[model samples]
Target: MDTAMQDRALGAVLAGACGDALGAPYEFGPPLVAEQPVEMRGGGPFGWEPGEWTDDTSMAIPVLEAVANGARWNETRTHGRLLAAWSDWAQDAPDVGAQTRAVLGRLTANTEDAARAAALAVHEQQGRSAGNGSLMRTAPLALGFLGDGGKRPLAVAARRVSDLTHHEDDAGDACVLWTVAIRHAVRRGKLDVRRGVPLLPRERRTLWLDRIAEAEHSAPADHTERNGWVVAALQAAVSAISTGDGLVDTLERAVRGGGDTDTVAAITGGLAGALAGASALPEQWTVLVHGWPGKRLDWLRSLAVRAVDRTPGPLGMPVRRS
Candidate 1:
């Protein structure tokens, strides 16, 4: 790939991570509260201090690791690796979302019905709690499956990975749709959410509508609360993208829109990063988020280079060596 494409891909990854970290400190705060400038929280609720990532980036780490190791879709080892990543995060005990914490707790207890219990618990407590958790970490999937020449396969792979815990069809579908959008934006160089939403594939379009309507009708009016609403997360992401603003602007918009702010901002930022690249991110924000484990900007750059190398070039040709 040319230097420009390489830069764009790297920018996308870094921008996504930066957005995740920046939004961490204000995850479930009031929309009005988030509108106020954030104070440096050192590493946040975690010991790492300011700019550290939350569950959003942690879950994504496995996706990138799996792809980097050349794992294919539906591979048992791939799924194991994904689960292992979650296990590792559990050991670290980061500031996890309530639904995720409960799920991981069951997985750690080694209950015979752990997976089923986790899925059911989230669905019952959070009402199909897809919650943008999977969406936030979906950028690597976009990178991995780019140039595969079909969106369905990639979408299916996204669903499989996310369904491990999210399970809800709506959640899985949102993950796939967001991944597709990010990949398309990265490859095509821009995205206009209002224009692009209508053009999504039929399945994705239907899912998008269902999710948005759910959010509009059911999302709590309060801006500072966290209800684990997946639909609200999707709406906020779409809103941020439609604004055509810089990373900080988009993230602030999403975060302030309330209901799962961090997750929503993280997901929106990933898509925006793919659409706009690192330059779209403010330097101070990037520096703040550059060093968290599995969330470093430089590491993301390396992963982006590797992912691009895997893409097939023109005329079904192999990717050309730089």
Candidate 2:
């Protein structure tokens, strides 16, 4: 990838984390009024430190790690590794989505089959599993699959990965669509959530296209009440990205929608970051963003690049301890 494309790829990961941290304090809070001030204030129900990311970004780290290890995303071994990593992380995660917590907590074995079965059981038990948890962690998967022509592999891999913890077809479809959109934005520097609609199952394309259109024409608030659902969450993220002028403003717009503020903003951040590039992220937010696995801003930067480069060598990104 060229420097510009690389920068956008880096942005997708870094800005997603930054957005997670920036919106952390506002999660489940009332929607902000238009032009209301926003900052990385932290101290939400989970008591996150200022600039500390939540599970949205924390869950993405395993995807990045799998890509950096050169693991093919569709393989069982790859799924096993991701499941094991997530299981370990959830053991102490301050806040995990109810759907994710249920699925991950039920795992008695860390294998891919076990994870999938657990996910399926949970979905059957509840009769609904279309949660935003899968989509939030899906951005990094796109970077790993950018090399595949036609992006077919990218779509398949996205659904497979989503299925590990989210059995709902809507959740899997959302991942495929958003991941494809992120891949396109990084490659072309444009925001088009609809760019991935054609990649959806033939029966589902028009439905997603209409959803994308609805998001474009609506405000983020339209989806905030149900943003925990994968489709509504995707809509809120897309609405913010399509309506706002830039990455920061888009994230702010997402936060203003309230409810699952951090998840919505993190979702918006991945696409906005892909379009605007890492340099477009605010220095203030980037400097303070930190999260699970002892990751700081520098680790996320390196992980983003390494996932794209698929380089297993020494860290290419400079280490900046915050």
Candidate 3:
């Protein structure tokens, strides 16, 4: 693996975990701007300890695990492995959402058909299932498919991964948009959220493009976004990054948005962390913050290295960022 890609990959995962743990203490609370320099303080409503990340990072770990050994995005076999992983994760993790539980609850070892059925059943029961649950865990897909070709291959991976649980097209759009943006961030050290819009399916592109504009132009507080809706979650992450500077600044801004602080910060962390590299992450948190489901920082780093290195590339990869 290229040393730079490895560092950026590590940065993306570690920073995301850092943001989740940092925002945990402030989850669903008032703005924490005054409480700047957010740390891995934990102790959110979920009763997590300091330095323990929430479901955000735990969910992504499966994606990294499933694909780290040269798994292609298009293989149906890959979805089966991911589903089994999610089933295993939900067994012990105490913080799963109701929608996710309902979807994954109906699955067995064979998951693709079951996932689709469960998604439809949940959607019918709830009247809507386009939550940020899928989007929050999608960064690993970005990492897994890093340099695997271009926008469309990564785009397809995003949709397939999102469809595994959050099957609604809106939720799929949010995942695709963010996943591609993360690809840009990790590859180029910058996240152009708009860059992914043009690559979307025509119908999905319209709504997603509008979402990007709203996120870019609106006030951070204007969205009043919780961590539920994919659009709202996307807006929250983009708004926080638009105004905040540096790693801590951006993450703190997301946490200060209050409701769903961990998810919002986590979303921003993947993007900002990719741009900044793992070395840019604060050493204090790096020493303390680790993931759940039996994953540590070093383990995740190895998975990320494999995710980037073991994957194959497209015939004519474009000239994206370095």
RMSD values, in order shown:
4.6, 4.6, 2.2
Which segments of candidate 1 are over 4 A away from where they belong? 33-35, 38-48, 108-127, 192-207, 210-227, 290-295, 311-322
- Please report, as a residue range, the 10-residue window in candidate 1 with the lowest summed lDDT: 313-322
Least accurate 10 contiguous residues by lDDT in model 3: 312-321
Over 147-189, each residue of candidate 2 has an lDDT whose tens digit, in order, gives 5363677888889989989998899999989988988887778
State the lDDT of candidate 1 residue by residue for 60-112, as single tens digits. Answer: 77787766666776565677667767767777655666666667666743332
Backbone collision count in every prediction? 7, 0, 0
TM-scores, in order shown?
0.80, 0.94, 0.92
Q: Which whole-number lDDT from 0 to 100 does residue 115 have in model 2? A: 84
lDDT of each: 0.63, 0.86, 0.77
TM-score of decoy 2 = 0.94
* Candidate 1 Cα RMSD after full superposition onto the native fold (Å): 4.6
Instruction: Rate residue 265 of model 3 by lDDT.
Output: 82
Query: Model 2 off-target regions past 4 Å?
Result: 148-150, 311-322
